[model samples]
Target: MLPYKNEGEIRRLEGLADQNKLTNEQRTELTKLRNERKAHEIQVAALFDKDTAKLHSELEKIDLKASKPMTVSTTEPI
Candidate 1:
């Protein structure tokens, strides 16, 4: 998923499966890889949700400040 370098073994196994020629070992490996992919997907999604929530919180704080009235001070430069 992160896209480093893989040897395309999954594709090889799938191709073999299409022909109904996959070995037992290959089937096990494919299942393991599929499960790992699911776990990675879940972890990435959780992180994204957390970051989104923090961003929304910060935006809300800024919005609240903006909604308040501003007062001018004589000591402040125009």
Candidate 2:
């Protein structure tokens, strides 16, 4: 899916493509938009992957803390 910021551009391109005729400039701009969208997708995917790894690391730490035994101390009054 196109990013929110590019939704308008995607709509415009869809309208242009639906017309079945494009000016040279329109075609060039369409190609540029497609490349930009592809680059955005790759960047977003990388960010998501990084975030997932970070979350997994955090979860592992939580699990380790939960598995460790806790200690309690009791003392008698002198």
Candidate 3:
């Protein structure tokens, strides 16, 4: 939920992660922060978009991997 709101803590945690030293709870929190940050960025980018689906497709293609895929969706009525 933090989503880099605590910049110092995020950096410290990331340093630990790079050293493979995160506790289970720290790892979970870091994962959540990264996800929330990514979602926030995507939403901001979508605000000026003319084609939401095209944006989603482009992002998916940019970050998607054979072993891991990311999904972005909206339920607003068109």
- Which of the numbered candidates is closest to the native, going by highest lDDT? 2
Better of 2 and 3 by TM-score: 2
Maximum-TM-score candidate: 2
- Where does candidate 2 stray beyond 4 Å? 1-4, 70-78
Q: Which of the predicted structures, 1 or 3, would earn the higher TM-score when compared with the native?
A: 1
In terms of lDDT, which candidate is stronger, 2 or 3? 2
Comparison by lDDT, 1 against 2, better one: 2
Which residue runs does candidate 3 get wrong by more than 4 Å?
Answer: 1-4, 50-78
Q: Global CA lDDT of candidate 2, please?
A: 0.79
Lowest lDDT sum, 10 consecutive residues, model 3, at 66-75
The TM-score obtained by model 3 is 0.50
Q: What is the per-residue lDDT of model 3 for residues 1-78, given as tens digits with 9 covering 90 to 100?
A: 223465667788899999999999999988887777777767766664747778888888766553364445333455
User: Cα lDDT of all candidates, in order?
Assistant: 0.77, 0.79, 0.73
Q: Which regions of candidate 1 fall more than 4 Å away from where they truly are? A: 1-8, 68-78
